[model samples]
Target chain A: MSRSQQLYEAMILDHNKKPRNFSVMDPHTHSSHGKNPLCGDDFYVYISCNDTEIEAISFIGQGCAISKSSGSMMTEMLKGLPIQEALELKESFLEMVSTDISPEKKKSLGKLKVFEGVKDFPARVKCAALVWRALEDALGAKSGETSTE
Target chain B: MLNPNIRKQFPVLKHIENGHELVYLDNTATTHKPLRVIERMTKFYTHQNATVHRGVYGLSQSATDYCEEARKKVQTFIKAKHEEEIIFVKGTTEAINLVAESFGRFHLKKGQEILITEMEHHANIVPWQQLCIKHGCTLQVAPIKDNGELNLEAWKAGINKNTGLVAFTHVSNALGTTNPVQEMCDFAKAAGVAVLIDGAQAMSHIEVDVQALNCDFYAFSAHKMHGPTGIGVLYGKHELLKIMPPYQTGGDMIDVVTFEKTTFAVPPARFEPGTPAIAEIIGLGETIDFLTEIGLNNIFHHEHTLLNYANIKLKEIKGLRIIGEAKEKNAIVSFVLDDIHPHDAGTILDTEGIAVRVGHHCAQPLMKRLEVPATIRASFSMYNTLEEVDKLVAGIKKIQGIML
Candidate 1:
């Protein structure tokens, strides 16, 4: 596939159209804001933790399809995983999107492999990782702002 | 009105993108450089590359002459009285900052005012804002009408005895509103307020006669006019520039050096502190000559036709709402589609090899006033054909089909 087609795939567009886990968790245990100031993309990732496992994960914000779809997919994949596991997932996702991770590691990313196309387009890397960055910050900190600049 | 010959001069126009012909409509951001400009720059670097003004050798003299000749070309193009009135800076942002620091801080006292329009780019607004914060002065913004036209009465009402300077854009970069700069300058002059016209968007699109406008300062960039980037011109009245202190003190700008204190050079040299963009300036001069040969009147006429064609074509698309509809606008058309954010639309447009700009366009306040986060802007140039406008329209329709 061409770079543009890979970046804006059919599944990604569907995810953008009807994003899953896109809401504000009222009694959220952890939440953090992610913003890309240059592109004016802003999102707030919310998570409810039960012990170490994630009871729920969701996001609410405005951005391009790449970011919105990635956010939707991120929340979909991270739920039911331990906070540490989610953090580990974030590291692998960032690595895979930015570099040539081995096929074994790429298989580990699962549905998040859709974002591997971002590696070819440098500018869209921030768009794809904004949600993951927010997820990492939400898992790591009590509450703060995470910016992909 | 579209000149096929003119379009042929720009080599980039011949290329295709994404299995489709490239439809470049983002002229306001920066124009595609003509072969003349590119060739001139290449020739300068290949043959006559040297540091200007300081070299006593023959090569240095030639480079200095090239730079000065470019300045003279600019002076003639803008119809400034003297070549020395033109000072070289990085771009419009640096030009405004230079005035804000040197003239603004030096002249305006505490509790005084610097007035600007709501339609100005961030470049024209921020420098004065910084000045206002540092000097305990006030920054006033004249509001734009709902139609995106500058409210002349409101702008005039903002000016008073306390208003030290009036800084406004000749043509708004966001909305293509061609401001009544001559009238505003006259009113400001009557009020004893100095006027500075930000001509970043105007110089390429229209004939800029600084003498006829009679403004204290005029500033624009070279890249926006098909010249190379990192070079700009700031044309200030000699009388005012002489009295205003040097913006930056450095090696080339010093008249005399002593342990006690160093004296500064006069006017243009005083303002230009260090090494300037010599090759880019020469390229700018060539670009100016190329445009002059085409005639600004002919270019304006061609672009007007393109704007009208694009405006009608874009309006035909359902759910598309144009942002600015000023009666006297240039070739910019900013619009938003229903439910689809500009970024999404821009992405879809790119698939069809159509280029446009989508953002707040560095006019966040104007965006706030317009009640939208951002808009899709398709700005035209002289070389843009009516066929390109059709491509843009078709691209938007495809975006609507996908997103809406």
Candidate 2:
């Protein structure tokens, strides 16, 4: 049993049973849908933003455990963070999972480090990144901001 | 029957991975080519390679003969009434699109219906969807039962006088469900609807008799049947072919071109526009001969035993849930572990020199119906054995242990 496999199992269980923020928001300031036509992974992210801070974040869609759980974890991490900080966190998350980053820095990404294992399996990277992409799209469209990562 | 020493006929089977013998379970995607098929392609390129059907030289005659002979082989393999019924296309995807463009344009009307099942591959579904959208027709799908089998009653109910065509897969690539295509065709005929069977998965596993099935059109790829890729056959009835317009227009399919008007050639040639996949077509001929020698009955029995063994062994795993447990199935087994992601399972198996497909398998609508994001699919070919099945089971157990 690899450590990566252990982490993936935990993530899948978390996503399947009590997914984090797995509900639709009443008044979402931003929302976007993304789909991977090749593997049929589809999901939507809803962001509730007020002025400079993210009031709440939720996702309501169906996808693989990786994407779903990633969405859940992203929501849990991004809630109450300033919108600019949330966008910055998305960039840092991208760099953390990308293969170009050194392993030491990847391990330092902390809770976001669960995704480092996905880099070894190229195919799953898309699933793990689906939520991030949706979040990026939603935030970009809402704030008229472009991702620097 | 392939030569008794058939293992030697495939060079790739002899390959070793990670110090372990290779156990390929991805035949549903594309099969390893037999040596005879390889040799035929090599020989074509080495000795008689030339542009076909236009040159008056010796090379042209040889190339044309090999190309036409390959078409005849496909004609005989599918047992089509006439050789002209076999039109060489890129593969099953292109063949379906050809039908959608030509026959679909001619037969389908506004407000008509196109009936397909939930088990259809995207190639079978998307083409019809495009046609329906183009012609103002409706695309209706017959849903599957809990056991992953098509609801025949629902299929019958879906077809009526307004149904223009009923297209379905002969075998479900994801579920391994062997659809009752002939029976479905009979019902469609009674309903006055044309039927097209996507034999991409079926051609490799079972003996296909288009005439017996009485489908209006049958499509299959060479790569799935131990042949080369980039080549496939579209078998349509001669009457239907004659009525359908050309899918693509170009050189060989033209009869006489005048400044004012142009006339087209007949049937097979009319559908094939540009230069075909000549070398691959010849290789497909050799692949058919290899399968004919092995006899589909023996191949079918061998795969059935393997599938049953795999099913029983897979059932013993504590947290593994096999998807698509259809009563009538081919040699595919799709499953999802209790906690592990399918991609993780695939990666773990690959490390042990076992290869399997992991994903939705281009059946998005079916996935939506099944309520699964993705599944790990282990598909078998005649070349696979019980020993490989054991490796697969062992790999899955290891995956479960690691995840748990």
How do the candidates score on chain B by TM-score?
Answer: 0.98, 0.97
**All candidates: TM-score:** 0.95, 0.89
Backbone clash count for every predicted candidate, in the order shown: 0, 2
Candidate 1: regions farther than 4 A off? A1-6
Q: Is the docking of candidate 1 incorrect, acceptable, medium or high quality?
A: acceptable
Name the lDDT value of residue B330 in candidate 1: 90
lDDT string for model 2 (B146-249, tens) is 88999999999998889999999999999999998889989898778899999999996788889998899999999999999899989999999998988899
Q: Positional deviation of B22 in candidate 1, in angstroms? A: 2.5
Q: Mind giving the per-residue lDDT tens digits that candidate 2 earns over A97-121? A: 5576766655545577677666666
Interface RMSD of each: 2.4, 3.3
Best by lDDT: 1
lDDT of 2 at A94: 73
Count backbone overlaps in model 2: 2
Clashing pairs in 1: none
